[model samples]
Target chain A: MAEIPAALLLLADARLPAGGHAHSGGLEPAVAAHAVTDLADLRDFLHGRLATTGLTGAALAAAACAYAAAYAPDADIPPSGDGSAGGRRGWRGLDAEADARTPSPAQRRASRAQGRSLARAARATWSHPGLDALAAEVRAPHHPLVLGAAAAAAGGTPRQAAAVAAYGAAAGPASAAVRLLGLDPLDVHRVLADLAARMDEVADEAAAAAAGGWDALPAPSAPLLDLLAEAHVRAGLRLFES
Target chain B: MGAHHDHDPHEAAPPAGRALRLGIGGPVGSGKTALTAALCRALRDEYALAVVTNDIYTTEDADFLRRAAVLPDDRITAVRTGCCPHTAIRDDISANLDAVEDLQARHGRLDLVLVESGGDNLTALFSRGLADLQIFVLDAAGGDDVPRKGGPGVAQADLLVINKTDLAPLAGSDVARMERDALRVRGGKPVALTSLRERPDAPEVAAWVRGALRRARGAAAAAP
Candidate 1:
């Protein structure tokens, strides 16, 4: 078995100060709508979300890991960084792909907002040429792309990046559910533990799909999530951004 | 996944710019929003300013500021806290930082930017990364004993405002004891007693804010 990067732990931790705490990963709206009121409904929601948004985000992160792995900080690249035109175009294309996958405008905004926050934290934590290149290309790179680049910066493989992405997809909302509903936190952990194997499976599938190239990355859609995100924006009283 | 990690105690100060960022935080109904509005009313004519409010459940704070007409509509922005107000202000200040930067970019230059936190507990305090100067407000009606409790806000905030002084008599709370306890915990930091309903302009707190702005400006200028 290959050794895992220690820095992957920091990437996976929810307390990295990257602004992930402010977002509910669509759980806020679900709770507000009474779609998820208890632990049982939460389990179902996580399962479906993991299968759809989780998988898509994981695949994108894996693809982004590939791009970031190719960046060599020691290389005597052009001062313009933009002069590495191919890399610039590549990152932009990946960001656009992420936008394409997210059908909800509100979700896209949230993703990009998170991406922007993660970009700041990632750059401050690691010195990776790919991160700077991506930042130059897209001011607010997609969250998954930043995760993937950060993973690569931390010496993690595409698979590890996918794992982190998939875990966050469910964990963010699970934590939010605990806070919003006052559910037993112990039971929430049990639910996350039960989904561990499935999360690994989704990450594996995403890592496998990543090899097919960015254009061929997963683009799964969850129409209900999209509608929920939009509805969250219009909510007169909301505790979450999306 | 459950292991605890110690956050760095030395928070890097944000790059000094044209504006001085002031953070106001305290418990619900402690008048953080009101103080922010009062500051806006007092300082808008003197300085190019804007406000960012962290609203936990609604945009009521932002809406109230708008209704008060202290600053123009575009000058105020609201950030949702996702039910964890402390996290937005202390742990992960990205959303608030985004709003602040957006305001600065829009205005080109601002003299002061007030970031009002969502009403939270005494344990809540602003991150040094988010605020150049922080003020923690406490209402006299909440409990005079609260200052004696001395959480991080009371102990570390640059300024402590013991507000709603007029209610002290009605609530049977001792205003002098609140100030004494707060000062005792604060290690000589300035504490102001305010009655916004009576003064309306928050004269003492606003004066303290003006002093803070001056000291911040002087520090920024002195930095090599």
Candidate 2:
């Protein structure tokens, strides 16, 4: 096992101002449908989400991290930070992969919106050539790809990027549960604590999956989550972006 | 409104070659939407204007602006606050920034962008990174004591507007006391009192906005 990279904490921190706060990770629509009314229901929903979209997100992040780690220019690069054409093509392909994995158009929009915000925050914070190239190639790259590139920028491994992605997959919804359902914050956090080991396991699987090549990356789609996201868009009242 | 410009020397100058972003924030039902509409109607002829509304639940404010036809649909954008209105404007301003930039992208260059915040409590404020200037609106009906409370919004905002003055007598609120208390805590900042129903144009506030826009343009022109 490798030591944890200190920068992983910053990448995963909710306070990074990357527009993650506005997103509920499908928790809002779940609560609206009465699918998750309490901590127990929320626990089931989180576990289910972790098993599906969480795993897929982690795999995507791992792949993106691996790509950035391999291709990103070092700090000594010129001020222009000209990324190779191959790097830009790689980023665009990964972005298309992310879009393909996201079945729902609404979910795709939410992912891109967050991705754009994360790109701005990452470029400003890390000043990495890979992040700049990704931004240039895909105006709105998916969130997990930016997360992976940010991990690479922060000197983290693919496993670390997967872990951060996996954690956000559950944590974003858990926090939203507290606000939307008015659940006990402590109890909601306890739910996250119980699932911490599961998230790590998913991250481990994701890192292993990334090594299998981009075409072999996991594509675990949550049909119900897709429905919820679509419904969330046309819903009369909505607090979260997704 | 008066000519009392309280420019903080430490405040970062507004970014060059963009609309001067003005934020309007206050408690629920304090007439933020109304003021935004008024400002749009007042200034749209003179300047290229756009709006970004942080409506709590849905695009109510943006919809209202559209229905009122203050500006074209392309000029107005809505940003959901994810249940924490203050966080979108003050803590993590990315969503609002994205909305503003989207508007700019759609319409080339804009002279003004009004980012109306979802109704929040007195402590709510626009991050300096988001709003070049902020106006905290308080209704006379909420309570005259609200100004005396003087939280960050009331005390530190660039301009404070005591709105719904016409309802003061009906609501048994003292407009005089509200103004006095606001001025006391504002440290020489200007305050305006208005009734949107009577003066739909919000002439005094519009005049203040014109002056602020002029100064903002002058400053942006002066910047490197």
Candidate 3:
């Protein structure tokens, strides 16, 4: 039998207890308001989310990991004392773009929360100097940044990192939907399985975007999700954050 | 999976030694923030205390505590969960953990870290990984039936608190029945009836926390 890479296993373990279950990815309000009602609607919602927010987020995370891996040899990325790394100019730009693309304040906060959580978990489980340095550079690490650092620290390829990020983005909301809409667990599993089957394609897109370099990153454009996210923020009776 | 197996040897060591983490959760307008403030006032002089508050869109809870001067601003950190309060405390606790570690790193010796979840549904409860003990607070304004409804917070929290007992009569809530249902659902896991305005000290609740901390310290000392 072939030896399983512990990094992959660790990243894939749903039970690692990273706290990914509470977020519905704005699907709660979408479902509550009847914007997403059935399987077909769910598929569309997932597709839209994957193409826009999911695609952008996965690419960013992959790129962040690639940057961390590429720059690992240079321990001066944060620039001692001055706190400015000439080599990190591209990464700074990418982080800014991510911030701008995430229009909803709630979504941005959620992403940061998840990012910091991933960073803490990685720090506790795998204390890589490079990862720690990156976390320190950004006082509030974003999710993709942490995922990228973790992936690199664990020696997982950029593709694998993107795949994990995509899976988590889709699976988290789908699981929430199962509880929110009272859908069957088996049916939710089916949705996740179907989503999982497309992991390679999503990973490829993310990988390609990352390879293109941060300067040539894609533009952000997911208006409906943003609107739903905004609406969710105003809806006082909401159960999910966006 | 390939990822988990590959990194097994590179994993970092567990936290050296730490005090018990306590989580405070409850519904909206349930006096969770007030309870946190009161606890700080009551425990700060005796035990080194740090607090983490989760707010959906702002740092209102942390701001409130800081403004109240319960502890220095550095002793408290706020997590903007963005969506569900449950996600910050239960689903994903990285932010919360970082806040706790930051406090401990700066203070050097913390006896307790209190995590207050943003106002949420009764289903919300802290994950064991995030908190050693959990407190669930509900108010008379939510009605007496809330306890009987038996959500995870009421059924599973290590300690349940029904706040605003003073408002029960005005709101037509039965504080006695609420207490009865809470004990019934919790199977004897201690419930405290508190009126933050009337009894900010809440000696009984404070004693419970003290006892829990003592037991936690003993267990940690015993660990190999």
Candidate 4:
């Protein structure tokens, strides 16, 4: 058993009210497409998501947190504090990388949309220069990157950021699954508990990958999630944003 | 309709930086969307305007506004509530705030912005963070006793609208008792009865909105 940062739990709480409740992270369309029907199918769905999109998102969060934790306010700029100019460039580069990895137009929009909402709440909550840099630099950052920055602002490490990101990737969709499928909430939690060990392994992998710098971060993509996200937007009746 | 002047004087004007936000809220099938469309159509020529619709599962409200063509298509944005309409308008307003800011950025200084809530229960009310003023609608057909059973929506909203007055006779709902009960629970907050069937343009409601805008600007002007 390893010690965890208290802030990590705070960041991972689905009840944080950062507007995440509106997004199903491709679960709605997956349910609609009948790719996820019963609890067993849900188990497979969570596993696949935890591996591909979850891992990639965790790596991005780790990288963003690392960037923020290492922020150095420039001695040169006084009031304007373009002080974060270097960090701004780093955030921009990472955002571009996120864009490159996101294959679907709809998924990209969803990522940015969630990111934008997270930034609004995070900037108010932490008031950190690194968050300022992220906001000043990018039009709209990706969801994982913003989560990582928020995690750092709340005094978390890159690994903790990775853990929270990976947790969100699993937890959000699991919550959505309960609502969409009418599964017993306790049964869903058991499925998530079963994935707990795997979640940690991926978080470790993401933190290690992030240490190799921006380009070395994981870029694993999920084609079905992307396809489903695109389908969800065009859906006439849907309960989720993604 | 402008003669009804029981607004809360303690309600100060919004800060100078943004447009005046008005929230339209009500129970399911309560004619909230109809009121929003009427307001837009009536006021678009009078003021720079835009709207945001908080929809539970779909973009139906936003789509209706677009189809009506009361305002330009770009002026309307729909926010999905993930099934909790009240949360979007009240507890967590990040998405609605973003939509409002985006509309302002794109369209410049809008005199009024309407944030219409997804159909919800009688207890739902917009948070002050989201709307400077709020209108709660109830269908006469829902039940005459709804007004007597005072919830936050019926009691505290800036305006309470009893809609579908034309159906009162067929539905056996008494508009007079509804109004009296509303007056009792509200302690003199304004209430209006509307029949969209006869006045499709919603003249009285539109007039009420005009009076609201006037006060918002008047307070803004009076402030130092």
Candidate 5:
């Protein structure tokens, strides 16, 4: 049997203790308010999240990581040593674009939190200077960006990075449903397995986005989800953070 | 709200990376906000301070702090949970974590972050991953028997506070009984009575936080 790399296993382990369990990724509010009820509704929710929020942000993050990693080995990249790669005005532009595209403060906070956590974990577990450099650039890194950078540092391909991002996104909501709706854990696993089986499709979407380059990247649209998120904020009693 | 100024003025400084985040949680009107305000006023000069507040709808708590002029507006950020406050602080803390880092980026020398959860029920408690120390607040107006009910927040918080002692006389609450019951459930962690309206000093609570912050900073410094 071919041996699996330890880094891959470490990155894939859901229980690695990076603190991913607490968030429902906005599903709790959707479920409690009947925005998402059963398997069919959940499938729609996951698909929407994947297409709009998940795909665009995850792809951008992967691309950013790749860009940073590609420039890692150059000794004279720039002595600014500020992790901005020679005061690359272009990087600042990219950061601004990301800030503009993400309208929901709640969503922005969630992405940044996950990014920082992933970066901190990667810094401790891996020996990649590029990942550390990327982490140092921003106070709150976006999750997809950090995940992409971490994957590169860990030697996983962009395809693998997308797979991890997609899986993490899907798994959060499915687990939340299991707890909120009292669905069997076995049933939640089955749903995740089904989603996992389609990783290639998800990865392809992410890769396509990466290939298009950051300037031409497609913007995601899920107005209903955004509206639901806004509504969830005002809800008096809810089980999830939108 | 003070001007939004970066507390750490040094450029490209390495992350200090100290501080243990402690979350303060309780039902609405239970004095979580008041307690947080008190802590900021008490601890700011001694320890580098930052705050993250989860509000269900508006940025009320953050706004309140800013208005009170306890901390700079930038140091106190509001996360509009748009859902359940628990999810942001406990379940999915990505947003809260981001808020913390943003504060750290602007003010890199932080020694403590106080996370305030939206008014929630007894079941609400901070996830261990998000908060090193969790303080659960119960108001005397809620009822004397609340501590005996033994929900997760009541039973598991690092420190449990019976607040609104000033209201206890009018509400006819047994503050001593509540303290005993809380002690019985918490297995000797610690419990304090707070009258935010009267005793702004809140020496006992402040002392507990000072000790917890010291221990948390020590642990962080020791991390490999």
Candidate 6:
């Protein structure tokens, strides 16, 4: 019965101009490897991604939300328009923890790249100190951290941040599959629709784990996805950054 | 929850002491890259220069610049556009920004940095966030009516270049008509008519860029 922020839709909207459109979320490489060729293959790919990176990202976002909201009440200071994030120091450790969780250099770069872009968008969209703090503390906090901070700024709870993370984890790839493989838009939306319940379950797990601190956040890894990302960098042709 | 900010077109100044970023964008096969290379060759001797190219598929544009040896192997950085070259340059410019900043960091204090968009359509215009100024290139061979059918790239870009004028007579394209139409749509903004085949050095475009760089640096100095 918890309320979702009206602005959460904006944050999760693909049209928000966070530069996520230029990334296929590793689906391009999976397609290159012929691991995802048909609707069924894509569904399986989505399931695997939702279980792995999706779960990890949701936990990180939930943890970031918990961290930010906990600090928000006391930091009633005005926003820093000069791109400063004041009074929020807990984000850096979470960023480092994200670094440790991601072993592949390519994935780290991708995450940092997405993080930096998200920071710019979130700062411009929301006036919360958490965003400026995150921006100042972690010049490039992982994408989910910015998402979580943005969620908090939008007055959403940890569960909603987890949900946004879970949605992005699957949504970005589903959209990319349409572009890269020329798959039917309806079928891909159906695939995402079918995963809704499972997505909710994962988000709940992430939110439940929120109060346990950064170390306690979920740490799911997809080895094949990482390998595919590494391979995608040297790939002869690509439409996505990772 | 948006920030209370000015709606000024050039809001965020280029990173302190960073190179002036000039975007080159136009339709596929419009000679955007050719002009970029030509400008590079013409201006590299006078200024510390670099290029960031957005490619929809592969690194062909960057590769071409490298093959031509216009600046150097390292000065050219290629960014993937996820098949939407317009989004990378205009709506969501983070990737292109990263590429440009990376090049500027690697080679410090560049006088000019050209961010060339992947060959895109007339709707593709570089965001002011990415480029300090933008140049939209159109081939006269594209048709004399292209400027008449003005889009954002044709109208809003800081400079417009109607290139490939040598083929105008052969292609039956009236350069004078296109020039007149471009001037009308652009509200007296600067427009150049170029034939890269004859002027491979892109001297006129180079002069425009040099003036922009001087003004950008002056504005930065003029800033508080």
The DockQ leader among the candidates is: 2
The TM-score obtained by model 6 is: 0.89
Stretches of candidate 3 exceeding 4 Å from the true structure = A1-4, A71-90, B1-21, B24-92, B98-113, B116-129, B132-201, B207-224
Give lDDT tens digits, candidate 5, residues A37-124: 8877777777777777777666766565555566456634442322332344434434544665577777776666666667777787
The DockQ values of the predictions, listed in order, are 0.71, 0.85, 0.21, 0.64, 0.12, 0.64
For each candidate, the alpha-carbon lDDT, in order, equals 0.87, 0.89, 0.75, 0.85, 0.72, 0.84
Residues B37-102 of candidate 2 have per-residue lDDT tens digits of: 999999999999999999988998889999999999989999998899999999999999999999
User: Which one wins on lDDT?
Assistant: 2
State the displacement of the C-alpha of residue A25, model 3, in Å, after optimal TM-score superposition: 1.7
The clash count of every prediction, one per candidate, is: 0, 0, 26, 0, 8, 2
Sorted into a CAPRI-style docking class, model 5 comes out as incorrect
True contacts kept of 5: 0.10
- Predicted structure 1: lDDT: 0.87
lDDT of 2 by residue, A121-163 (tens): 8888887767777888889899999999999999999999999
lDDT (10s digit) by residue, model 6, range A1-242: 78666898898899887879988888999999999998999999989998988988898898787667765757553332211123223677778767777878899988888988888888888888677778888767788889998999888988999999999999999999999889999999999999999999999998997757566667889999999999999999988888
Residue B50 deviation, candidate 4, in Å?
A: 0.4
Itemize residue pairs with steric clashes in candidate 5.
A22-B91, A22-B92, A23-B91, A23-B92, A109-B95, A232-B82, A232-B83, A233-B82
What's model 1's TM-score?
0.93
Minimal lDDT window, size 10, model 2 chain B:
B3-12
Per-residue C-alpha lDDT of model 4 across residues A1-242, encoded as one tens digit per residue: 45676766766887665789888888899999999999999889989998998999999898888787666364232322122223534677788778877899998998999999889888877777778889999878899989988887888888889889888888888998988889999999999999999999999999999877576667888888888888888888987788
Worst 10 residues of 4 chain B by lDDT: B1-10
Residue lDDT tens for model 5, B156-217 = 88778888988887888998888888877876667888888888767778887876666556
lDDT of 4 at B219: 76
Provide the lowest-lDDT 10-residue window in model 5 chain A.
Answer: A78-87
DockQ (0 to 1) for model 2: 0.85
Of 3 and 5, the candidate ranking higher by lDDT: 3
- Provide the lDDT at A167 for model 2: 98
How well is each residue in B1-224 modelled by candidate 6, as lDDT tens digits? 01111122442346567888889999999898999999988888888999999998899999999999998888999998888999999888888877887887798778888999998988999888888788999989988999999999998887789889999999999998998888888777778889999988777777777777666777889978
Candidate 6 ranges beyond 4 A from true positions: A75-89, B1-17, B221-224
Highest TM-score: give the candidate number: 2
Per-residue alpha-carbon lDDT of model 4 for B91-174, expressed as tens digits? 888889989999999998899999999999988989898899899999998899999999999988888899999998889999
